[model samples]
Target: MTERDELVPRRRRDRRGRGMRGPAVQPLAATGHRPPLPRSRREVFDKIMLDVVTDIDARWSEHLGLVEYAVEDAPQLPDDWDSGRVPLSSLVRGSGTTPTRLVVFRRPLEHRAADRADLEAIVLALVVEQVAELLGIEPHDVDPRYPSDLDDD
Candidate 1:
């Protein structure tokens, strides 16, 4: 071995200086030969949230002024959080120049739901309830599809 080769460590040689090694396990989502999997849970949740917001906004655009919607993977809770229930969403009303901000906690809602349909129902119910609170009106007034209305159908 040359003087430089002898000085360097065996593991740091990078496969005898050929190139970097590939990952030990390939991710199935990236493999080209197989059919692609469905959209990610986050993505699906995002779409559902958008659809619900769009439908509601169309009817309330004049009064709502401006609103911001967001989705977080999970909420950060304190070590000694005393509450037994975790919040599924948060709504911060706007004042003056600030726009209303609504945030949905994806993980908590997904955890409570039994299936895709249940997730949709939960998201719709929470969003409508929050929007109603913001507007100081009944949830059914915000959206006819609110949980109460679902029972009549």
Candidate 2:
């Protein structure tokens, strides 16, 4: 061994003697082909909304075909509105040649829901209300599960 080789420990040196050994690392599992992670909360919410639309469309294909469903991160509140207050969860807009669009605001709905089940109910109710508006029918006519008492006097 050379004088320089003698100064360094055997475990620390490679054949070149210039480089030091690093800690051993195990190979990662073969995860490349594994299934994707579960859907995100927002995606799950959107799916719930879509499912409601699909069910409604099956019953009223002619009416639903002309409408569009959308998701927004949050409702655009008026500047005069209180900061601590949450805005409406959904809105239906359009008329005449324009396509009727039902937009559900995700953050406000999530904030209002107590849990997953509650969120599902809230989304369904919103969809029903909007569809009823589009069809000029009562919300209960669209989805019987929608509470009749929710209508303003």
List, residue by residue over 1-153, the lDDT tens digit for candidate 2.
899899986674367765543333222353334444679988898888888878987887777657777888988778888778675455546678887677778888888899988998888888887788778898899888887788663
Give the per-residue Cα lDDT of candidate 1 at 69: 86
Q: Which regions of candidate 1 deviate over 4 angstroms?
A: 1-37, 149-153
lDDT of 1 by residue, 102-135 (tens): 9999999999999999999999998888888888
The model with the greatest TM-score is 1
Give candidate 2 regions above 4 Å deviation: 1-36, 82-85, 89-92, 148-153
Give the clash count for each candidate. 0, 0
CA displacement after TM-score superposition, residue 16 of candidate 1 (Å): 40
Model 2 TM-score, all chains together: 0.66
The whole-model C-alpha lDDT of candidate 1 against the native structure comes to 0.85
What TM-score do all the candidates reach, one by one? 0.71, 0.66
Model 2 RMSD in Å is 7.6
What does candidate 1 score on TM?
0.71
